[model samples]
Target: MKSSPQLPPGTCDCHTHVFLDEAKFPLWAARRYTPPPASIEALTALHDRLGVERVVIVQPSVYGSDNAATLHALRTLGQGRARGVAVIDDHTSDAELAAMADAGIRGVRVNLEVDGERDAQKATQWLRRTVERVAPLGWHVQLYASLSLLGACADMLGSLPVPLVFDHYAGAQAQLGLQQEGLAEVLKLVESGCAYVKLSAPYRCASPDALQSQEPLTRLLIDRNPDRMLWGSDWPHPQPGARPNASDVCPPFEVDLGKTLNALASWAPDAATLRKILVDNPRRLYGFDA
Candidate 1:
């Protein structure tokens, strides 16, 4: 139980999820892979142990637009201690959106990568439309898209009605290194303060020497704009995943979260920068009380 690399006070794990009772919050038929029960109780204990004071429960792609599970987690955690980012379809009503806002949801997620959708044009369209939909709620749009898709549409970032939140390094390809096309654009977006990037799931984009390779990647964002950065455990980190029709389950990745925080400290320019990433930024982005 080494939660060594101490987390700062008011530190928020900005990107995490909890998959509770499937009977009540069933998975979508079109989902890629089944996830094991990663409940709020487990999440709370883990956060408590790690010294993280606040959390943001992001809607996992497996649930599609059904946010019951995410909302449940937020309620169980209680306000001031937790907030959420939900997933919604065109069918979701304004009343429902308003209800979610009241329940402490601060954002909506647009996950293009999970659907295996490679159409950069379509991805950009979805993002723009999602921004329009959630804009009225004053919620930022969180995107989980590939760097290639992202690279093709960086020009569109400046014109969005709402702020953008990039998940998992904005789909940067660790192996691609300098060849990661959207990397520069993402850096610029952070620099311009039009978007926020989560320094999360480094293992997802890891190269052979993952630790060494991930350093520069995380550092680049920290260096460009620490104010716009967020750090998340991406807890219960699921494997890459299988087809929509696949019957098998995707087990989570094993990570030493405390050590990962330490690594983030190394990437950030200073202690205050780390605090900005872990505390100040998430509070402002999610509307947590001071």
Candidate 2:
């Protein structure tokens, strides 16, 4: 096995999650799949092996808007080493938001793809509402949707007061490279500093043979603006399994995150840029100390 890269000090895995103790923190009834016990210990071990020092534990869709499990993990890891992105709704209280902010929650997640939502109108509405709520708190809205949906809502992006974050390389079409449908809009956001992208979870999106395109995709992103790029282990690497309301619990993908970081090493043009993705960019975005 190839060893993981020795990342710079203060390197942060910009995205990851922890799901454990189901009796205390049950999965959402409407979730598409049941994830295994991705507890904080497992996450810490994975990051330690990968040479990552900090993490952003994003609230998985299975947890819905509860934010409890994610917040618990963030609190366990503590604000200094961990930050979070929660899932909230209109009914979420300002008190709760303040508590989350204190717990180091820097953003909110809108994972429409997990909901199998394709309508851009609904997505646009979601975007508007979520962004408006989080804007005053200086938090960004992190999104996961089809590229088509992104393009449909791209026009309104500039008016938002806070930065937007698109995870998983903004839904790369591996065979399509920069020509991926709707990529132009997302790339423009990255270039103009209106948005950020997380280089995570390629195994969830592309076939192995087509993984070559990630290099060019990363190159284009860097050429546009390296400062907006981030890298993540996406630890335990959850994949959608049998639909929710089913009896099956899907085990997480056995991704060697060391390899994932190595892939990132190749994507970046040099040592300086890789440090930006693994360290500086996350510090700026997640409000981590320098």
lDDT of 1 at 228: 93
**Tens digits of per-residue lDDT for model 1 on 25-61?**
9888887788888989899999888889999999998
How many clashing residue pairs are found in candidate 2? 0
Cα lDDT of model 2 by residue, 1-290, tens digit: 36988889999988888888999998888777887788899789877877789999999888778999998998798888999999999899999999999999999999988777888888888889898789999999999887767877888876688889888877766666567778888888888899898888877567643455567777888889999998877777877764454447886676766666778788789999988888999999999988
Q: For every model in order, what is the number of clashing pairs? A: 0, 0
Clashing pairs in 1: none
Q: List the residue pairs that clash in candidate 2.
A: none
TM, every model:
0.95, 0.95
Task: Rate residue 49 of model 1 by lDDT.
Answer: 87
